[model samples]
Structures are given as structure tokens and as C-alpha cells.
Target: MNPVVYTVDLEVRWRDLDAFNHANNASYLGYIEEARVRWFKSLSADWAGETAAPIMAAVQVNYRRPVNWPETVRVELFAERVGNKSLTLGHRILSACDGDVLYCDGHTVLVWVDRGGQSVPLPDAVKAACAG
Candidate 1:
């Protein structure tokens, strides 16, 4: 079954540009981070350290095209793999004005951890949410 995707729209800020006048590569990660946070919030997941939280374990991004300011981008997040203690979320950033234009694509691995920072089992609710 195809996993359900969570999406968020973000406007490219002028500050996100580099001297080259395109969105900086580092800024792409920030966009992904925002989308992830929004996705977690949508799930009502306790990600803010109430007890256990998900932490970034790894990230991989591929730049397909440059994004400029005065543009809106759509970020989509889907569960790629849900594991015992970690999950890989696949993401794509595209022009909100034209979904056909993909600006960046990537996946991030997040591990559930306790306050002590040791890996722990993912909550059932989180697993269910990732299922779709």
C-alpha cells in the first residue's frame, strides 16, 4: 500500500538566497525540517521532549533545480520505512506554483530516543501514523 503523505507549503524567503541569488543548499534542509515538524504536529506526536522524541539520525538530499525567492514551494513527507526504533521519511520539495518542477528530493532517518538519548521502541501511535 502506498503510504499517506503529509504536505506543507512554504514561501521562499529572501534571506534564504545566497550570493548567487538562488536558495542556498543549506536552506533546503531547513525546509525539510519545517515540514517534518509540521507532520509530527499533525500526528499529535510528542516530539518536544515530554518523554521520548525522534531525533535526526541521517539525511540525504538531492538538488534537482534551484529555487528563487518570490516563489512558494510545496514540501511532501511520507514514511519510507518504519522500523523498530527508527523510520525513514522521504520528502520532495516542488514549486507550489507548478508541481511538475521538483526543486529537491531526499530522505531523513529519525530514531526515537528517550530523554537519556538512547534509542527506544517507537510508540504504537507513531508506527500507526507511519503505516499511512
Candidate 2:
């Protein structure tokens, strides 16, 4: 277990709520995505355009508790393993106020892709940043 390298905060929005007044199941995936994006931006030299941006090959999420609107959501992202072409990032969503965990999750298997979308080995910089 390594310290999370990326932390992103998301404020719950009205649109994020479901009929039950809690964050919808689908919205949880968006929250997870925020953390991953933050992680990539930090680890990659040019995530927005120049360098390769990793793509998700798979995702697994387990919702533990419902989140109501107006709550500040905090997400932490970290990697479990760094392979030649892919890595598994660990994700956690929690309430910023009480620290109640809303979801405990595993990552999307991410592989580096070139501008042409061909799979490539993670760059040395990415490998160093993701190494745990």
C-alpha cells in the first residue's frame, strides 16, 4: 500500500444525484475518472496533447455507501503495479467532512497509446512516476 500520488476534489452537484437524493451509481464512475485524470496529468509530460495519454482497458468498482449532494467528495489515486505496457491504479472515494468512504475501487487497466492509437510501452518518465 503506497501513499496516493494524486488527490482530486469533486463537489457533489445536483445533477449527480439520483431520485433517492444520493449520488447516482453512474456518477461514481465519473468521480473515479476525475482522480485518474489528475494522476495522468501529473505523471505525463503532455497529457492534454503532446505525449501519450493512457486509455482504460477495464474498470471494476464497488459502491459502499450513498453520497448526498452538497457533500465535498475527495478521491485518492494510486497504482498497485506498473507493467511494461499497463498499470492498475487504486481508487477511493470519500466524504471530505466525515471521511466516510463512499466507494472502494480498483482501476481501469491502462495502456499507453500513441497518437495513432497503437499500444506502446509506458515511457520511462511514466514508469518512474507510476512505480510504487
Candidate 3:
């Protein structure tokens, strides 16, 4: 198992559900994104600056169970790997009421990009932040 570096609790909204009364498939991506953004902000307050921002390159998600509204989900984020120009993040979305029940799991790769949207080597500061 990857080490969890950050975690957040997000509420399931009514609109997130589908005809089956469970969260739509696309909603899981938003949940993971919320955790990722929060983790980035925790690493650096000015993480959104133009010159050294990261962009999502790819994402892969596996749904384990359905989630319903009026519930709180726990999203755990991990810094699985730090590369020269990218960061590989692992995530687990669990049922807040019961931590052992996993709702979804995924990985995302973020590439560091410059103002012109070209890939660049990650900054030293960014590396240091992930080292923890």
C-alpha cells in the first residue's frame, strides 16, 4: 500500500447520484480532484502561480463500490512517485462511516508545465515538499 500523505472528507451531493441512487462514474473523478487540489495547496499556498504549475496528464480510476448521497466520503491522497517532470499520486476513496469500505481508488500523473504549457522539470521546492 502507498503511504497516505493527505486526506479530506467531502460530502456527496444529491446531484451526484444517478438513476441507481449511487454516485455517477464521473463524480468519482471530482472527488479525487478535490483531494489532489487540497494536497497541492497544503504543499504550497502559491501553487497556482503561472510559471510553475502542474497539469493533469493522465488518470486511472477503479470503482469498488457504489456511493450514495447524504453521505460523507473520505479521500486519502498519496505522493506515490516524484519524477523529474511529473508527480504520480495515488488515491483511495473510502466510506467515512466505515473506513475499511473502499468506494474507489486511482492514480493520477501531473506534469509540471510552464506559462506556455510546455513541460518543464519540476522545481526543487516542489520536490522538497513531496519528500515529506
Candidate 4:
């Protein structure tokens, strides 16, 4: 099955800019987080339930180009790897107006954990969702 790709469009707010007048590096992560959350919600599963939740284990981001204000950025996410206890999500940030203009790319690793913070196998529903 083809992996599901999730996309979200976000406006570059003025507050997201830094001294260079472009979006701050931290802002890019925030954008990715928003898109990731939205995607998780779309799955319609209790991925963040009290009994078990997915926690970020690692994150890697590569900034390709600066993003200016008054622009809309499209954040795309897809499952890169779905393991027994962990999932790696690949992401790309591109100009919504000009899709060819890529701003950033990255991946985040999420591990399922129980209430005691011990790693657990991912829920079948989550795996099915990732499988698209």
C-alpha cells in the first residue's frame, strides 16, 4: 500500500521572523509540529491516550531556503518507517505558492510508550493508518 501523505498550509506570521527578516529556525519546527499533530488527529486513533502515547525520540531538520513573511508554507508529512515500537515521519516544507521552492526537510522519530514510560508496540490502528 502507498504511504499516506498529509499536508497542511500555514501562514508565516510576522512574529515568526527573526533579525534576518526570515522565519526563525525554531519556527520551522513549530510548523512541522502543527502539521504532525493534525495528521495524528486525522488518523482518528487514540495515539495520545493515557494508557499509551507516542513520544518524540529524535528529530532532524535541514533548512534549504529562507522563508519570508506574507507567504504561505505547505508542510507535507509521510511515514518513512513504521516499526514495531517506533515510527519515523518524513516531512517537507515548501512554498504553497510555488511548490518548487522547498524551504526545509526533516524526519522525526516517535516511540510508543506506556504510562510508566516504557516502550511498547505501536497500536494496530496506528500501523494501519500509516500504511494508508
Candidate 5:
């Protein structure tokens, strides 16, 4: 796996948990979104156009353990591969300090699209950012 680990620490609120007191499955995707959005923002002047957030063509997530609320959790992201028109992004959820505690793992395929709804090559700026 060409895993590139990117960590994002999220503070769990009471509302983030379900009736069982663990983070809901859907919350994990939200965590991925946080990391992905941050990465895009950090990449200078590349994917940004006149409008719209990046689009996802596909995603795969694996839940390993339950995350309790009021705890600070870390979400780690990595890309398995980068294709001409799409990228395969993987994510691992942890407790930040404790890398051994894995809450889940996920992968997402983000396609480069334009306003006209066509797949384009990921801008050089973004590819460069990922390379580094």
C-alpha cells in the first residue's frame, strides 16, 4: 500500500456519539472530509476554480473499533494511488497519541472534474503537494 499518513485531531462532542455512546459510522466520513478539505486548502492555487468543492467518485471504509465521545480522536489519511483522472485516498482513525488504537480505515476515490462535468487530470499543483 502506498499509504501517506495525514493526521487530523478531532475533539469529540457529546452530540457526535450515538445512543450507544460511540461515534456513529457516518461521523467517520465527516472526519475524512475534514482532512481532505484541509489538504485541498493547503495546496496552493490548484484545484480552486470559480466554484464547488471537489467531488468523490467512490469510497470504501472499514470500521474496526468504536470511538467514544468527549475524547480527542485523530484521523489519518493516505493515498494508495493516483491515476490520470482519479486518486485513491485512504484514511485511518486513531487516538492521535496512541497509534495502536485504530478506530477505522477508509478509502475514497476523488475525480478531477470541471464545471462542464468532465474528468480532468488532477492539477499539477495538487499532485505536487501530494508528492511532498
Candidate 6:
């Protein structure tokens, strides 16, 4: 298992619940996105709106179990791979009440791009910051 480099604790909102009484499938992505964005912010205050920002190239998620409301969720993020122009992030979402219950796990590929949307090598600062 990859070491958790960053983490965010989130509550499963009432609106996030589905007809089955568990968090909706789409809500999982939002949870992971929150953690990912926070990770970038930790790297730099201006990372979110910088001229050369990173964008998601692809995402793969595996749902392991259902999550219900009233339970806190812990999102763990790890920097997996850093490439010339991209970085892969590994993530795990688990029930805060019991860390052993993994609700989901996934990976996201992010590509650095300039304002013009042309691919560019990740800034040295980002590369160094995310090195694990």
C-alpha cells in the first residue's frame, strides 16, 4: 500500500445519500476531488489558478463497499507516479469510524497544461513537493 501523503476528513452529507441509503456513486468522485484539490493547495497557494495548472487526464475508481450518511469519511491521497508532464495520484476512501472498512480506492492521472491547454512538463516545484 502506498503511504498516505495527504488526507481530508469529510462528512457524508444528507444530499449525498441515495435511494438505497448509502452515498451515491457520483458523490465519491466529489469526495476524492476535494482531497486532490486540497493537496494542490498545500503545495502552493496559487496552484489552483496558476497559469500552468494540472488537469485530470483520467480517473479509475473501484467501489469496495457502501457508505452511509452520519458517518465521517476519510480520504487518503498518495502521489504515485511523476512523469515528464503528468502525475498519478492514488487514493483510498475509508469509513472514519472504522478505518478497516474501505469504501473505495482509485487513481487519477493529472497532466500539467498551460493557459493554452498545451501539455507542459510539471514545474520543478510541484515535482519536488510531490516526491515520495
Among residues 3 or more apart in sequence or in different chains, the pairs in candidate 6 whose N, CA or C atoms overlap within 3 Å are none
Q: After superposition, how far is residue 7 of candidate 2 from its true place, in Å?
A: 1.3
lDDT of 3 at 82: 93
Give one digit per residue, the lDDT tens place, for model 5 in 1-132: 564646679887777788899988888888888888877777755565764235898888899989986778887777778787787888888887688998988799898787888777887766765675
TM-score of each: 0.93, 0.86, 0.92, 0.93, 0.90, 0.93
RMSD of each: 1.5, 1.9, 1.3, 1.8, 1.8, 1.2
Most lDDT-accurate candidate = 4
List per-prediction Cα lDDT, in the order shown: 0.88, 0.78, 0.88, 0.90, 0.78, 0.89
Candidate 1 residue-wise lDDT, 1-132, digit = tens: 245478899999999999989999999999999998887776774655578988999999999999988899999988899899998999999999999999999899999998898899987767888775
Kindly report which residue stretches of model 3 are placed more than 4 angstroms away from their true locations once superposed: none
- Which ten-residue region of model 3 has the weakest summed lDDT? 43-52
Q: Which portions of model 6 show Cα errors greater than 4 Å?
A: none
Residue 5, model 3: Cα distance from true site in angstroms:
0.9
Candidate 4 per-residue lDDT, tens place, 40-84, comes to 777765868879888999999999999998899999988899999
- Native-to-model Cα distance after best TM-score fit, residue 72 in candidate 6, in Å: 0.4
Residue pairs with colliding backbones in model 2 are none
Model 3 residue pairs with clashes:
none
Least well predicted 10-residue stretch by lDDT in candidate 5: 44-53
How well does candidate 5 score on lDDT at residue 76? 75
User: Model 2: what TM-score?
Assistant: 0.86
lDDT of 1: 0.88
Number of the candidate with higher lDDT, 1 or 5: 1
